[model samples]
Structures are given as structure tokens and as C-alpha cells.
Target: MPLPLYLLALAVFAMGTSEFMLAGLLPDIASDFGVTVGTAGVLTSAFAIGMIVGAPLVAALARDWPMRPTLLAFVVVFAVAHAAGALTTSFPILFATRVVAALANAGFLAVALTAAAGLVSPGNKGRALAVLLSGTTVATIAGVPGGAVLGTALGWRATFWAVAVLCLPAALGILKGIPAGRGGDEATGKPALRAELAQLARPRLILVMLLGALVNAATFGSLTFLAPVVTDTAGLDELWISVVLVLFGAGSFVGVTAAGRLSDRSSGPVIAVGGPLLLIGWPALAVLAHEPVALFILVFVQGALSFALGSTLITRVLYQAAGAPTMAGSYATAALNVGAAAGPVVGAATLGTEAGVLGPLWASGLLVAVALLIALPLHAVITASRNTEVQR
Candidate 1:
């Protein structure tokens, strides 16, 4: 990997920490603001909402700007939001800060993925994204848990302050390390927004987008509810919850690392293998819920495989949308936020019934199965496209 890949990793680390810290700090934030933990949880949802909306919106608006400045500007915006979050005492003000922070968070990542892809040779783009996204995986492994512990010890405000502190070095690294002329400004061709939109209107791109949505819904739909269900229904302690969460995070780290290598070689097998694995694992994860040891193993495996699907899928989208790869990247990133935002809502509604904790996981499994059905068509589309390209 290049030095720029490493520098972008730092920015990803900072952004990932800033974006995900709230999930572990919800209780502390609620206590600090005299609100319910439920309300504090909305902060996570708020951030996801901002990402879903801000990604395409910002990409459309700033498609013409020089890439480095735009990426750096978003990082600055994110840093300021964290600082503001640390300082605010009122709920409304803090919530506002979170929304602003999330917009910056979303935009920064969308731009970074595009920028990172631009930095590398064409054949190595998948590795580049995986490396940049490794920060997100690492954040899940270290940052969130550490932030939770820090929130318990130093207060939630202090955690945000810590994240804000890291952003300074990230900005400096980008400024000094990343080469010029590799940003959106130079890469962006004539205004192809309408043309790209027309292209996406084709059945193939729509299938890709739909597959992105279904895959996201399948995994996050269950994951968002995992902690609550495992603890509340299974009568597991917080220690076990932390352990399970760590296991999931660890599995994800391994999966993300492997995804780059796998996609670099054969993206089709990754998707074909991953989708059905989730179909199997989700059901098994729910069935083994009563067996703690077995469930732990299943959760780890499921987390690892579930995440690998989307990253693998992204390479296919990039290949298909060769003329406007950044738009494909933008859509994939936005799908992430959209899935996260939808997960809790879907899980909460499903869990409201008598089906209880297992209900959501089962529902998620069904969604994955549906995604598998979608992936079949996607695989055909990719195969046909490849064959066509070869013949030409």
C-alpha cells in the first residue's frame, strides 16, 4: 500500500470514532442531559440519517471541487462537531451538533473512498478502499469499546473531546502526505450527473442498488438489535455482552482484511459464498441463542461473513459503473447509512411482537435469503457484462 493509503486510514480512524462513539455512550449522554437512554440512542439514528442524506447531496454539490480540500474541509467540519458535542450541555444543542457532525462524517467518508480509489492504480482500487475502511473495522474493535470504558470513567463528553483531539493530526497528515491532483477536481469530467442518473436508471444498476439495500438490511437489521436481545432475553450479563460485541468486532476486522484480497482475486465467489453463509448463519445464530457457547461462535462467524458481502459487492459495482465509479462508491456508502438507519426501526418493530429476541434475527435471516435471491441476478448481470466486455 502507498503512504497516502496509510494517511487516509488515520482520517478514517478519526471519523469512525466520532461517528460510532455515541452508541456506547448513550447511557452517559442521557444521564448528562436528563433524558432517557432511548432518546440518547436517537443520536446514533440521527447520525445515520445525516449520512444517508448528506452523502449524495454533498457529492452532487461538491463534485466539481478539488478533492483534497473537500475531504479536508469535511474532516474539519467533523472535528468541530465533536468539539461542539463535548461542550454542549443542552439536549437540543447537542443533538444539533450531532447532526452537523454526522453530515461531515458522511461526506468525509464518501469523498475519502472516492479519493482513495483515485490514489491507487486501477487494478488495486479494491485494496485501497479496504485499507481505508480498515479504520472503521479497527474503530469497532478498539475505539467503541475504549470509548465506552472512557465514558464510564471520564464521562461521555471527555470521549468526544478525545476524538476531536485526534482529528488535528488527521488533518495535518492529509495536508502533508496525500499528493495533489488526485482529488475530485482533476478526476471529475464534464458534468455527467444527469447522464449518470440516466445510466443508473437501467435495470442493471437498479439491481445493484437494490442488492446493496437488501444486503445492508439483512445484517444490520439483526446487529442493531443484537446487544439488547442477547442481554434482555437470554439474561446475559454486561460482561458477556461486551465479550460478544468484541467477538463480532474481531470477526469483522478479519473479514474486512480478507475481503480486499478476495475481491482482488474473485469478487463473484465472495458474494456467492457470503450471501448463503448469512442465510445459514442467521438461522443458526437464532437457533443457538439458548446455547451461549455455541451462539458466541455463530455470532462471530456471522458478523465476519455478513460484512464481507457488501465490500465484495462494491467491487462489482465499481466494475460495472466504470464510467462513473465515484457515483457507485457514493451509492454504496449511502447504502451503509441507510441500512444502519433502517435496522433499529425494523428490529424494534419486529421485536414488539411475541416473537421476542429471536424474532428480529429470524427476520434478518429472511432478509438475507431475499438478498441471496437478489445476488443471483446480480451474479448473472456481472457475468454477462464480463462476457460482453471480453467479446468486444
Candidate 2:
């Protein structure tokens, strides 16, 4: 990978931290604003909603813009939004800031993926994406936990202030590392909205998007309620919660690294193996949740498989939407956010049932099964299409 790619990764790390750190800080935020925890939880949904709406819109508007400047602009705005969020006392203002920050974060990631892919050869596209995505994995491991610690020590506002400060290096890295005129073919003219939409409307592309969504839904559905399950079912102490989360994050890092390398050769085998692994892992997790040792092992395994599936799904989308790579990345972001947003709803609904704490794991398994069914046929269709093209 190039130096510039790592710069993009740094930006991704900062953005991802901002996106996820709120989960740990919600209680503090709610209390500060004189609201319930449930109301504060809406902040997470607001961020996802912003990503869903902003990604495609920003990608379309900036389709012809040079990648470096566009990325820089987004990071700067993201930093500013964090600062505003940190300073705001009113709940409504903080909510608005979250949405604005998410929009910037979405744009930054969409352009950064395109920029990273452009810096590498076609054969290394998967690896490039993996390296970029590792930032998010790292954020999960270090940034989220660190933010929680900071929020605990100095209040939630301090965490946001720290995030705003962290963005400086990422913005500086973007300005210095990314070269001018990289990404997109402005000389060829900006793609018409209809052309971009046509590319997105392909059957194979839609399937790929669905695959992305399902993978996220399955992973997050169970993960969203993991703490309760671990405590209620596994009989683990509250102190072990952070340890379990760390284990999951570590597994995600390893998974992304392996998936990146393997996906460079072909994504099909990775997905073929990973999908079934997820299918098995989730159900096993449900049954094993009461066993502390087994629960720990299963959580790690599930996290690894989920992230591995995500990497391949992105690679598959990039391959399927070759004509509109930037838009493809944006759409992929939107699809994943859609899943992230939906997963909690599904998990919460399942939790309300008699199935109790283990319901989320079982629900996640069913979602994975549906995804695998869709994936098997979609892979066959994509393979057949490629074979036909090769024969010509």
C-alpha cells in the first residue's frame, strides 16, 4: 500500500471513532440533556440516517471533483462538527451536529475508498480496501474504549473534544499525502445522474448491496445486545464486558487482514466459506451464551467472520459496479448503514419475546441464513456472467 492510503486510513479511524463512540457516551449525553437513555440512543440513529442520505447525495454532487480536495473539505467539516457537538448544551443542537458530522464522515469515507482503490492496481483493490477498513477495526478496538474511558473520567463532552482534536492530524495527513488530480476522470465529463442510477440498478449490483446489508444486520443485531446476553446468560461479571468487546475487536482486526490478502486473489471463496461460518457461528453463540468460556470463543469467531464477510462484500460490489466506482462505494456505505440501523430494531423486537436474552443471537443466525441463500445464487449469476463475457 502507498503512504497516501495510510493517510486515508487515519481519516477513517477518526471518522469511525466519532461514529461509534457515541454508543459509550449516550448515558452521559442523555443525563446532561435531561433526557432518557432511549432518547439519547436516537443520536446513533441520527448518525446512521445521515450516512444513508448523505453518501449517495454527496457522491453524486462530488463525482467530478478531485479526490484530494474533496476529502480534505469533508474532514475539515467533520472536525468542525465534532467541535460544535462538544460545545453544544442543547439536545437539539447536539443532534443536529451529529447529523452534520455523519454527512461529512460519509462523504470522506466514500471518497477515501475511491482514492485508495485508485492508488493501487486492479488486482490489489481488495487489499487496498482492507487496509483502509482496518482503521475502523482499530477504532473499534482502541478508539471506542478509549472514548468511554475519557467520557467516564471527564464527561462525554470531553470525548468529543478529544475527537475534534484528533481530527487535526487526519486532516493534515490528507492535505500532505494525497496527490492532486487523483480519482475520477473529470476530462471524460461527470457521469449523468441517470447513468449512475443505471449502474446501481443492475440486478447483480442490487444483490451485492443486499449482501452487504445482510452481513451488517447479522453482525450488529447480535452485537447490539451482547452485554445483556453476556451478563444474563453467560453469567459474566460487568468487569468482563470490556474484555469481551476487546476480544471481538481483536478478532475483527485479524479477520480484515486475512480477508484483504485472500480477497486480492478472489472474493468468491472467502464469501463461500465465510457465509456458512457465520451461519454456524451465530446459532452456536446462542446455545453457548451461558457458558462463559464458550461464549468468549464464539464471540471472537463471530466477529472475525462478520468482518471478513464485510470485506468481501465490498470487493464484490466494486467488481460489479466497475463503471461507477465512487458511487458504488457510496452506495455500499449506505447499504451497510441501512443494515446497522435495522439490526437494533430487529434485535430489540426479538428481545421482547419469550426467547429472552439469547433471542438476538438466534435472530442474527436467521438473518445470516437468508443472506447466504441470496448469496449462493448471486455468486452463481455473477460467475456465469463473467464466464459469458470471457467467452466473447
Q: How high is the CA lDDT of each candidate model?
A: 0.72, 0.79
lDDT of 2 at 51: 87
TM-scores, in order shown?
Answer: 0.88, 0.89
Distance from true location, Cα of 52 in model 1, Å: 1.7
Q: Assess the local accuracy of residue 57 in candidate 2 as a C-alpha lDDT between 0 and 100.
A: 90
Q: In model 1, which regions exceed 4 Å deviation?
A: 27-40, 89-92, 180-191, 382-392
Prediction 2 global C-alpha lDDT: 0.79
Model 2 CA deviation exceeding 4 Å by range = 26-39, 182-193, 230-239, 355-358, 382-392
Task: Please give the range of 10 consecutive residues that has the lowest summed lDDT in model 2.
Answer: 383-392
Pairs clashing in candidate 1?
Answer: 67-184
Candidate 2 structure quality by residue, lDDT tens digits, 248-347 = 7777888888889987566678788888998999999888788889988988888799999887787767667666756867877887777776775677
lDDT tens per residue, model 1, 46-85: 7778888887778777776666787789889988988998
